[model samples]
Target: MSDGLPMRVPAPGLPARVRIHEVGPRDGLQNEPGTVPTEVKAEFIRRLAGAGLGTVEATSFVHPKWVPQLADAERLYPLVSGLDVRLPVLVPNERGLERALALGAREVAVFASATESFSRANLNRTVDEALAMFEPVVARAKAEGLAVRGYLSMCFGDPWEGPVPLAQVVRVTRRLADLGCDELSLGDTIGVATPGHVTALLTALDEAGLPASRLAVHFHDTYGQALANTLAALQHGVTTVDASAGGLGGCPYAKSATGNLATEDLVWMLHGLGIETGVDLGRLTATSVWMAEELGRPSPSRTVRALSHKE
Candidate 1:
């Protein structure tokens, strides 16, 4: 592990290259107790792209009343719009989509939940109602020539309703896939998922005619299982993973939810397994460290701490 590099040992039954969907800029900063400065958010996105993250979620266009942290989406988008990497923003509805589209955005994502309680809590809509809401949004985005991603949260477990059924998750995700989302990002919102549970969900989706290649896994580290669950997804043929730099952000609405899988940690494991993610671990770790300083706290990522100290 010289110079913060992991020894490559290619694994069997794994994709040669995996895409890291960096979410720290948007999903990561939205949960901060205080709003991060717009300039800082812009710099973070640039640093992530510079670290070789091919796709970086830039910001969300939700109403400022809902997420004041990202209220500066309009001001923030312009600063990072010229970046060469893909910049995807989260759009909750047509208004959000309009705001993103006005800013020349080519990629947008819609966030949905798999459980009723979460749907009501997050979107004030039931599972069916939420999907109905997104139908037009996805269609409109696609019609406008934008790539759309569907984020299905609470796939594993929910705070109010314990342990979700596999069929329940599969059903919701299948609908999202049908909405013409280029990809579905399945979320373990409360971080209670185990490896077998991860395998079972992927299998169910496959049976439902939704293959793993069209899915991305978004795992939280509350139970310290994010990395293990991610490994299970990779073994199951999922190549796209959603991770936050410095392991920042949780479900602002889900009180029990925790920080997402750290990009630094995921890159370490992927590089170790000889998978290509086109990310520079040292630069990514340095970016997280810089962000930790801006947030006025040390990063929670072990790899960030380890590699950062060496630098």
Candidate 2:
């Protein structure tokens, strides 16, 4: 846990606390068409931390040509370095990793796709070729004492190749674990995953020796199944979940992909279920409202919409 936040002991059926890995700042803003000023981005991250999100993904170190929105990674990291939260940046390759380390980043995440079509489209390489690229990145980060997170995109279905096979997902997940990823985040990139798919994939991973504790679920709300898929993961003992504040992200590579599961929505459900998340829902909703103003739009979060009316 970042900043030594106390973790609750999970009960028999459900985890007492679920660590919400907030990715709004990085994954959320990366797909925006217009530029968000560096100062505004910094303040947004500060507000997220203030709302008690301990593990917030601050920015991506990908080259400016690929993700121009996060081109200020060097400038942005220093601004939030003093915060008592786990600020993880995304590193796509060794060069990306070098940039992050230069900024004194303590944790970084690498992404790969499960299908060849998406890999070719997103990373400009085949699935095997991308993993070959990530191998050294993960190994080097681990050697440098930085926590490394592995992201497997399109774990359930792909836009180009529909209905990805279960075997392929498990194979890629196990390979990431073998390559020394501290944790693997399974992504439903197009939001096509149902609860049954979530349960089966998780069960397959466990059978392959990659336990649920080493996994996190990243779901998109395109088909309105993000929350339901998340529930399936929770029932199967997955404790880490990836969500965006105000439902702020979409996939640039996969145009059909939509916003991520809203942080406010996830927190509301956890609180109702008597699960501990250490997040202040009122504060989270306020932050979302503030960010919506910055983006010049209303937040996509249902919880934010409903709560803003009361406020």
Candidate 3:
């Protein structure tokens, strides 16, 4: 939206407000090679919400062996439990759910891959097997009065399989909806999606009985197309978008995958479109800059860099 291109009017029926589901803390830092101290992760979540992110993914309940960076979920969740934001944790299974419940988590997310290769590599199970494992986890979380979000990874393409069929994504989406997931996030994990691909997939899913309102688009910026794909999703009536602060995190199973779409970049586009996100772009940019400093690297977001230079 900010490449000096002409801005087209949003199609009719586009939502006036878009909810940004910030995944920087959980999905972003989980893959960092060096361990971020538990306290630092907690502070990062606080800063994200302070920047007006209403929903912040707090941490993952995956075993430390799998993602050693987030093994401190217990210690980290309590630190931000009192915040006025919705903090959701990623639960891998029923055990993960129990761990989250014990810590007073009000929201939890379950993940399943759209491609068999990703499922086998990331979860060590077939796609169906992974969904079967999450069935009870979703039910238990909902019963406990916690909001359950389901994530379908590799919705557009897969690193191992390549060009995943739209049917596969639709089937998995329906299954997740049937499993009682309150919302489903369709992830372009390997970042091969173009705007046309996004429009086609959303149209197919809508025809398959999955409403665009119940779906969020999660894209990586490996191909520099995340924002364009997001615009496509918005025109099709998607109201929730998942992004990471400082464009953090990538799929470990996706060797070609880069960082998730930056929250600051999304905010810039949303604000430019006259869409209300309740997020302060200046504060969000500052948070990402601080995070980049903490990570000992340059901020990956173009918006953040431009804003920093102006400052």
lDDT, candidates in the order shown: 0.95, 0.92, 0.91
User: Least lDDT summed over 10 consecutive residues: which range in candidate 2?
Assistant: 1-10
Kindly list the per-residue Cα lDDT of model 3 for residues 74-167, writing each as its tens digit.
9999999999999999999989999999999999999999989989999999999999999999888888889999999999888878899999
Model 1 alpha-carbon drift over 4 Å, by segment: none
RMSD of 1: 0.8
Q: Pick by lDDT: which candidate is best?
A: 1
Full candidate order by lDDT, most accurate first: 1, 2, 3
Best candidate, TM-score: 1
TM-scores for the candidates = 0.99, 0.96, 0.96
Tens-place lDDT per residue, model 2, 1-311, is 23212243434588888999999999999999998999999999999999999999999999999999999999999999999999999999999999999989999999999999999998999989999999999999999999999999999999888999999999998888889999999999999999999999999999999999999999999999999999899999999999999999988877877799999999888876778888988888989999999999999898889888864
Q: 297, model 1: CA deviation in Å?
A: 0.1
lDDT of model 3 at position 38: 89
Worst 10 residues of 1 by lDDT: 249-258
- Estimate candidate 2's alpha-carbon lDDT, on a 0 to 1 scale: 0.92
